[model samples]
Structures are given as structure tokens and as C-alpha cells.
Target: MIKTSRKGEWLEIIIPEEWDGTSVQDLFRTIWNAPKKLTHSLRMEKGVRINGQGADWTVSLNQNDRLDIRLFSEQDFGIQPSYHDIAILYEDDHLLVVNKPSNMDTHPNSPEETNTLANATAYHLLSQGEYRQVKHVHRLDRDTTGAVLFAKHSFIGSILDHMLEKREIKRTYLALVEGILKVKKGSITEPIGRDRHHATRRRVSPSGQKAVTYFEVLKTDHKQNLTLVKCFLETGRTHQIRVHFSHIGHPLAGDLLYGGKPTFSRQALHAVKLELTHPFTEEKIICHAPFLDKQNIFTGIDPYSI
Candidate 1:
């Protein structure tokens, strides 16, 4: 495993045995997939070093070599900080995972919006004396509650974005739908596209992007005709889960937009867990968000137990 430490303004990384003889350029381009512009900036600004001295970008690395990169210099926290309470699930120098509450947008739609999760995250970072832009890795709907990942710096943020695109980050969700599925476990392989009739709705389209959702039924409330399901996504299409389940005649209990029953106020969906590989430290990271609603259909269900 790679070892990492935070200095005043630099991040110190110790090369591991497995990366022996890997060229610095290969590490940036192949391993991290850093943008060429950012790589040029790092080289021009002398932001990278080897053993406390300036680094030669083409030189091969050795095990235990000290590689230092200036990543966390104080900068403006781009978004306006909102001083509201937020539940942080996991945090480190490289990443943060926060338990987002219901009825909160992931980020602002306009500059005047301060009641967003990103604004609250900015406030949390400022409290720690770290000033960096709020960079969320993924997003949840306005009413969906769950663990959201954030990158503390742009370098790691870019790496995470690539990981998400490659589907290396596993996102698991817990949802309560209006009916018990005929099959206990199944996968939905459908293409989804924007709904022309509505501005913010998606539908399964024949010529749309490929979307896949895997699900396993966890429990069934036969009396209420509701089913609790654990869903995994292979693609991140807009409203993929909601649209897929709705297409199968089982809309989320409160997802009124897709013709669901008004069994609850908001959609009965929550991002229960996130699993990913740490970009720098090379460690497996798992974050879980417990059910956040007080009077939802999944009250008795324990998401962590799954």
C-alpha cells in the first residue's frame, strides 16, 4: 500500500514496492489520468518533487522514494458557506463522505442558493481551517438521502471522476417500491433517455444510452403491498433507478413524478452505501448512511445489516 501524509501545503507520498520503476509521467498519465493542462501547471509551478528536491517528470520511481506534491494550499472555498448542521460519515485529508439529509439539493442551481449540501460542506471545511473548493463526486436527488462523497482537492477529484466513469466506484441504494417484485433478484438492462413530454423526467428509450440496474429484494410488506430492495447501478444515467423500477410497474412509494402512489411525502429512496478504492493511499473505503427519515416505510429495516 502507498503511504501518504499531509504537510503544511504539500502532500507527501511514499512509493510502494509495486510501483517500482514506474515513470513519473506514467504515474500522472496512466495511473492518475491527470489532465494535460494540470500536469503542465504542476511541472511549470514546480509543484512536484522527489526527496525534497525538484522532480524530473520522466525519471523512473523506486520503492520507498519520497514523492511530494503541493496539493492543498489555501484557496477560496468557491461556494458560499452555509452554517447549518451536517452529518459527516467519513473524512480524511483526501476525501470526505457526508450523510445528506432529505429535502436538500446536492449543489446550488444559482449563485444565490446557500441552502445546498455543497454550501454546508464548505462551512464544514472552513471550520477545519482548510480552504478548498467543494467538489462532490456524485449527486442525489433533492429529496433522496444518503452518503455523498467529496474530494478535498482537484487532483484527487479528477482521479475519482475517472474511477466513477469506469464504474470502479460501487454505489448501493435502498429503496421501497409500491409492489413486491415477482422475482427476488434480477437485473434491468434498458436504455434510458430524456422524456420529451416533461422537462426533468427520463424514460426507457430504444435509442438511448445503455443503463443497467441490479436489484435483490430484501423484505416484503405484504399488508401494504410494498417491497424493500437493494439496488446496484452499472450506469449513472439520470433517474436510472426510478425510471427502471417504474418501467417494471413498481415505482418508488413516493416518487409521484413516475406515477407512484402517494404512500409517502417524498421518494422512498436512499443511498445506503458507497464503496471505492482510495486513489492515493490504495486502500478500500466503504461508507454507509443509515436511514434518515423518521416516518418512512423502511423504518424497521436496517440498511447496515444488508
Candidate 2:
């Protein structure tokens, strides 16, 4: 069998039909049955997790074992703006790192002229009449908030692309989930692939690409779980954090697409920090978003749901 990812990629798997995913996509594509964009990455080959060992699909599966994969791609013309003052973290001649808020797309996809973060950037450019082209280095889902890097031109984008490939960029997120986590810390290592039957779903399969995410439980209340997790992206797969967390049984709160309860209308995940080097200076830059950090998630709200 073959597995698909959230980005519409495929892989071969040799296992029983009843496994979590015979192919690779059985892990992430749950909300919809869409294909994931499966890109290649040599660095993540070593990070692949198969049952207990790190593998790249060369090993055959046993009976009930599982496989995990993660990968990333960098390709977008511009952003789709929600028309808001996007918090600027770091900016220079070559590139800019914007702290993207939730409900704003990193770039425009199927629906055009709908006003997204990318469109806002273009609007900003038009105000100057220079009309700098938007080069999207990274993206965030419309309802998923976090840091997004954008380039002004293709030349600079090339450099940023190489930086991403080299694993120079690190993204961190904080999410509130709906569950009482038993483990203090854990890692969700799975292979992500697209859903062939549906257009927007993903699954985990031994044959799919590789993905690894490390998570830590901060605190938990009766209604929700507050976790301060650091998702190290060995491979920057699409919806990696959301899918992996969902796979681990702790779906983010308000994430209707990934087992999360629709509590806040949008997912409770926030891209709180980012680490990377400047495109030209090579100076390591770390940007932090100001979210009320209580170490314990339940500290912010009453024990009972309001």
C-alpha cells in the first residue's frame, strides 16, 4: 500500500491492511481527503521513526507497528492578507520575518483577491510604487497563528530557501489542547502523506516521507490541556505540528480540523518564537512573540469552562 501526506505526496508501504496507515497519509489527513505536497529532504531521512527504530521505509513492517514521516516545501508567489498590521520581527534589504497572526494566510491559494497577509504585503509595496514581488519562504494556515518569513525578490528567496534546507530556521509553537495529558513530555514521529480519496486529508504510513515533533506538557486542567511545546522540524511538513499532535491524541483546542474542540473559533496554537540566521549577515536571529506565559496553561482561565 501507499501513504499520502497533507501536501499531496505518495510513498510505498508493505504492511497489513489494518494498520494506522498502509501507505503514508493515514496520520495527518483526517479533516479532509486532500493530497499533501510531498517534497524531498535528505536531512530528515535519519529522523524517520518506524515502530522503535529510525527508518526510511527500507524496513518491512511487523503486525501493528506504525511509521512517522515529515517533510517541507518552499514555493509561493505571495501572501493573502487579512489586512492587519503584521508584527514585523526582523526586516532588512534581503528578507523580512513577519509575526503572522491567526486567520491570515501566508499567501493566496485557490481563492484569489480575497485579501490575505500576502495581499497586504503587496499593498504595502504598492504604496511605495516599487511593487516588490512577494516571495513566500514559509506559510501559516488561515486559522493557525505564527511566524512567517517572506522575501521581496527571487534572488533573496533563493538564499532563504537554502537556509531552510540547511535546517537553519527553527519554529516554536504553543498550543492549548483538549485532554489531560499523562506524559510530561513526548514526541510524535510519523510519516505524513496526502489522502487520495479526499482532497484535504493526510495519513501516517511507513512508506511515506519522514516527520518528527517533540512536545512537552506544561499543565492541564479539567477542560483543556496547556502545553508549551517546541516542535523541532527535522523536515518542515505541512500541518506537521497540528497533525502530529492530533496523531498523539492531544489535538489543539478549537482546531475543528484536527480533533480539537471548537472552543475559541480558531486553533489555540501560536507560533511564539523563531530562530534563524539573517540571509546576508548570517547572524543568528531569534524572534519571540509576546503571549502570556504562565508555565501552567490553566492559570489563565477558571477551572470550569466559561
Candidate 3:
């Protein structure tokens, strides 16, 4: 568990018994998920410490030794805040969950792309007088709308990211694909890799990293030749759900990149639910985003029931 102290905006966590003889830096990298780029600044700036004193990177830690790490400041991000209407589904001092709108990039891809979810979050944090770093735990595609989670600072961000890597943070998506699923529920265990034929696309390949997606058919529209499916991801990859479903001959509607027709302006996908156990509180937490438009295919049916 982690707690904050008022003295220096440092987050504190006690080393557990399992990590009794581990090096400080190694533990930070593995358990805390601190990236290598942050290591130099963390050391030179006295950003990390143990037992109320700056400790050596290779110092062995004892159980119950308190470790503190300084929070990354806002200026480090180097992005100007841009105002945009964003819906915050949940918020705590440690975490922020936003219902990201379609067509908005989850984070900035280039210098020219300032109007992104990160920029909007920066503006929101500034308005709240929280001049600290905004770190997204995971990413949603530009045209996919859903719950996007962010950590308010680096320490929590690291922990949350570790949880994500461990598959502790569960995400469920609603996808409208262009076919009637023959099966009620099934798993797609396919490896995905960069498509050499298409520069920006991914395809199922044996040389690629392992990817798995599970789906349950929720509803079918024979007239539209579409089926709404609830999807669970076992692994996260670039365009994983879209690519896997497309490979199974059910490309998401409007996903032209994957051979889907333009029935909708963008791919018909939404991250409807997120469930996880709070790292600090150890309590179960779940958040959801409501449908943006009632006119969509899932108007009358309840997603929870399905």
C-alpha cells in the first residue's frame, strides 16, 4: 500500500517481506514500474530514498523499510494545456478515470498534435491546482471511445501500470462487427505482428507477439449484417481487438483499415467497463461509460444483463 506525506510531495511505500533482500533500484524498476529514463533524474535530484534518507541504487532493502519517491513535476511533460470538454467518470487523489470521446487521440503523437486527451487532462489538472504529471496507464485508439485511466503522479502510475501488465486491470469493450457470429462465445488465440504489406496495419502472424481476445455475442442485426459483441482482452497490442475480430471474418463496422464498410463514421467500438482491485485501498473498483448516442444498436437492451 502507498501513502502520501505533506513534507515534499513524495509517495511512500513500505517494502514487503517478499522483497527483503532486493536492490532498491531493481525493485523500483520491477515492482514499481519506474522507467529507465526516469532513473537518472530520480537519482540526481534525490527523488528516491529509504528510511528517511537518500539511499544508493544498489542498496539492499529490509522488510518494512519505507521507500519514498518524488513526484514528477508538470513542467517535465512539456505540453501546453488545451481546453476540451471531458467527462471524468471517477477521481481520487491517486487516480483519474475519464470517458474519452471518439476522434480524440489518447495522447500526443507529435508536436503538432496538442489537442489530445493528455492535453485536456493537463488543463483539467491545472484548473484544480494540481501542477503535477499526468500519466496515462493505457491507451485507447483515436477513434475508439471509452474509459481511459490516468495516474496523478509517477509512483501510483507505476503501480497501476504494473497491475496492467499483470492483467489485474480488466477492460471490456462493446464492438459492432459486420457479421453474425456463429458461436455464442469463444476465444481468439492469435499472435499479432506488424503488417509488412500495410505500413500502419497489424495482422495475425506466427512471428508476432502473442495476442488473445475473448468475445461473447450480445446482439445480432440480420438486416444490417452486424453483431454486437462484448470483448475481453487477454493481451494488449496495437489494434488488437480490431485486428483479431477482422481476422475471424467479422471486422468492426466502419473500420475501413480492416475491410469493414463505412456504415458509421468511425469503428463501432466502445470501452464500456473497467474493473480492478485498488492497489492502495485493496478494494474492488469498477467504472463504466454510458452510451453517447441512444440511436445506436444497443438502445433497448441492457449491457449488464448481457
Q: lDDT scores for all predictions?
A: 0.91, 0.60, 0.83
lDDT of 3 by residue, 115-178 (tens): 8999999889889887767889999999898889998877678788879998999999999999
Q: Return the lDDT, model 1, position 187.
A: 98
Given candidate 1, what's the lDDT at residue 198? Answer: 98
Model 2 C-alpha RMSD vs. true structure (Å) is 17.1
What is the TM-score of each predicted model, taking all chains together? 0.98, 0.65, 0.80
Better of 2 and 3 by TM-score: 3
**Ten-residue stretch with the least lDDT total in model 3:** 1-10
Cα error of candidate 1 at position 258, Å: 0.6
Clashes of each: 0, 49, 0
User: What value does the lDDT take at residue 227 in candidate 2?
Assistant: 53
